[model samples]
Target: MSAATATKTAIPPSGGGLSRESHPLAGTGTLLRFNLRRDRVRLPVWIGALFLGTLSTLSSTVSQYPEAEDRRSAAGSLDSPAGLAMTGPGHYLDDYNYGSMLSHQMLGFMAVLVGLMSVLIVARHTRTEEETGRAELVRATVVGRHAHLTAALVTAALANLALGLLIAVGVGGQGTEGVNWGGSLLYGAVHTMAGLVFAAVAAITVQISQYARGASGMALAVIGVAYALRAAGDVGNGVLSWLSPIGWAQRTYPYVDDRWWPVLLGLALAAVATVVAYRLSTLRDVGGSLRATRLGSPVASAALTRPIGFALRLHRGMLAGFGAGLLLMGVMYGSILGDAEEMIEDVDELREAVEKIGGATIAESFASTVMIVIAVVAAVYVVMATLRPQSEETAGRAEPLLATGLSRTCWVASHLAVAMGGGVAILFLTGLGFGISGAVATGDGGLFLDLLIAPLAYAPALWVTAGITVTLFGWLPRITAVAWIVPVYAFLVGYLGQILDFPDWLNNLSPFGHVAKLPAEAMEWTPALILTALAAALVALGLAGFRRRDLETK
Candidate 1:
């Protein structure tokens, strides 16, 4: 009657699809490509930083301690309980060679970073996708349920392997004294294994929680515990260290023992964890998790109704985590304050560099140097907090809240206030933590006040960092991540500039550079005031821009 529909309809998909269509990992390859594309810049930063850091450290060690006797003296300075807790087992000191020093001192810390990278990579791809509903959209097509997890793991695997190879090539290619090619290969293996183990840990955690942040929090907690266990275990009986993945990585003792079994153990654990994650994935629905979230109160509290209080609630977990983590980190840094003088006494270049960075007394100067590191870390929190509002907007949560009579200015200001206020609190905590530990280690009560006040000087610098994030978020939301450049450059210039022979103007480019090195010199409020004013101007500009622009459609 309609001319037989005029044209034939296209053939429908057959009931029996291709062999791989029904498989659990049908679209994993395609998903992996997407992940790689999405993380191109992010992945390269992680890989390159670790690689370059390792190379520079190795070069620094070689240049700083040339003769065998000098190396022995340097090793003796780091042989204390505090040193062992921070570095690794004292067994590596038996040889006390350059290779051993690099392995013992660097491996433990590097393993933590590698684990973190894997956790973030996996979380970003898997749980973050689910949180944003992208996973559901992609899954609506002919994709398997397990494809996302598989793709995320594959992404992590690629990053870790790339970093491992770089480390191997960097370490071995140098042909430095006391380091062999075989040992260099083992060094890379250590990082590779730790990364895979954490990637699997992330896979399992993502399935355990419905939220991306919760999943990431759990995975990061695992990393913290592993490092703590390694430290305590290394300080105690050697047996305890073996229980931790980080411990296993350290136990490889690249240049000293070069044990291959831990690598195998890591692989076995990765396989087991990955399988468990897959099994659990099958037990849950998309965008849901195995662990149920606790029910909330029916009525909102007085504070919960306000924008400031809501922003605080959203940021509480990160705030607490950063506070605790920084407190512990500050303690570890301070614990080594007692050895700072002895550690640098015999080395001319080293002593000059430390003095150049800080004060008259080596301990005071060392404390001052440590302040920059703490401030850099705190800035990380500032950047993250400042961007929280954008995250809410991108998630479609902010639009609804804004529609309910909350002015955009008030909403944005609330988050910014939290970012700035939280920065102050975190800085205080870190400084206080350093004060307590440094006081204990040196038996000088005055050191406590000196150290505590010293770190606060960087608060203005931190504010500048937050302001940059705000400015970028307002005018250039898509490129907001450029804000990280402020801190990264600060670290490179503030911490390593003297040694690297970086131009003095480069240091001035960072807000941290403008801040007077506290406790080393008297506190200069002029720079602080200038930085504060600059930050305010920047924030205002950003807010103006944000108000004029249309809200991002999510």
Candidate 2:
């Protein structure tokens, strides 16, 4: 070939059809089988957990308030300050049916979990392989650049499809006569579509980021923004909801409006996102991005000179983000509290229930409820932030830092400080914000004082998560995944206990289960102090382990 022609010639997409002989492309089918084999246990567990949890929740809700009036009373309680604070907008409570409540409380979480699964799986398949050098060997053969991405998405599609079917069966089997099967499928479809769209989104983000963490952060940021937009739209004017993918899914109003059309919209959006990802992939080189990373300092700064400083530097951004989010959530919930009493009038029986639950003014009940929710959400943040160190250790980044003059204790403590301190600050900020707003709307400045006490109630729970993280890092580094299991199990048990009729022993396992739902009820110091002590002991155990163990070899 002429030099000019040779310069312009491109490699065939799959090594010119010698896929297996020349590239991993030929092994796609084999990889598919292998991937399924590898995921057999993990996939089943994840899918089953989601399905069973959802089913249990649905069944419980249906059972708890069988009468329409009872449902209305439950809704009324939600319209209280505590209720609005804990849950989102109060309108969903008006329906007092299984479907509406599930949609309100469960739908967003479902989307988020599904979306996260999609992003993590797809990014692991594509970017993780590239980062670990596995993709290069596969690519050297005849594998298409897009092969891993496609496989990852194919896997997510299968997972989501099964998840959707499970949800349909779970909800439909409840024997709620005239239960909208179509709506259940619509809910599942929207969640599945969200997963697919985000899988594509993660693929595109991985191409743009140099590190898996960066890619994961990008995808998570998208999820956060989408959720925020939806919340803003749902609570406020709702014009902004149109901009969020999550909003589109929720607006499907699966059980309420049972709108089937929006599911199509979500699918269409996912298709477009996939196409865009493919086009973007064509423009980037393997393991590189169109966006370049900026150069670092020529010399190590004071912060970089120590592990604690490094941990702080790495985690501060996320901590700050969580703090801001908490504040805004507080403000939104507080602002809505003023309207709670008014909204409750739509259902007199529900209003009566609110009075019974709080046995006082509706405002008081709501304020108390809001505080509990703030604590719950802040606790979640605590777990996530505390566990950051484990992620670093597992990823091998902690090794270099440990080699540098950092002690194991200091290294672990830095992350713990961020998690515990950040959780306190975030929850406090939320309470403060909500109190201020509630006071303004209700013409009761004392509302601020009342709200202030709420987040403090959560401190013990937050600390527990921090200490658990530390303990896991020291003693069970490989199984630190269990750290999250604590929070997840606690959350499910506490929230679903009344609904699912679980045995007390099962419920007692969650440390958080002991936390008094504060503000709604008077503060109970015993549980709080106990949790705090337990957390401290756990941290000590973790520190002891850390002192004996070798720095992560990685």
Q: Give the best candidate by lDDT.
A: 1
- Candidate 1, residues 132-247: lDDT per residue as tens digits? 89999999887888899999999999899999988988899998988999999999988999999999999999999988888988999999999999998888878879889999
lDDT of 2 by residue, 1-554 (tens): 67786575656665355534544245566556656786787688888888887876677667666787767766765665444434444556656577777876777777888888888777777777776566777777656666776777787788888888888877866767335787777767777877877777887798888777678778988998887777766666668777877777777776777777767778788888777777787787777765797899899899777666777788776777778878887887778777777765554443554554462457777565445456667877787788777667766777887777777788888888878888888877888888898888788787688776677777888798788777887877776767767667765655444334457788677776676655566778888889989989988898898889876653
The TM-scores of all predictions, comma-separated, are 0.94, 0.82
lDDT of 1: 0.88
Model 2 TM-score relative to the real fold: 0.82
Candidate 2: regions farther than 4 A off: 1-18, 21-27, 30-42, 68-106, 131-142, 232-239, 251-259, 341-361, 498-509, 514-527, 550-554
What is candidate 1's TM-score against the reference?
0.94
Best by TM-score: 1
Question: Cα lDDT of all candidates, in order?
Answer: 0.88, 0.73
Number of colliding residue pairs in each model: 0, 14
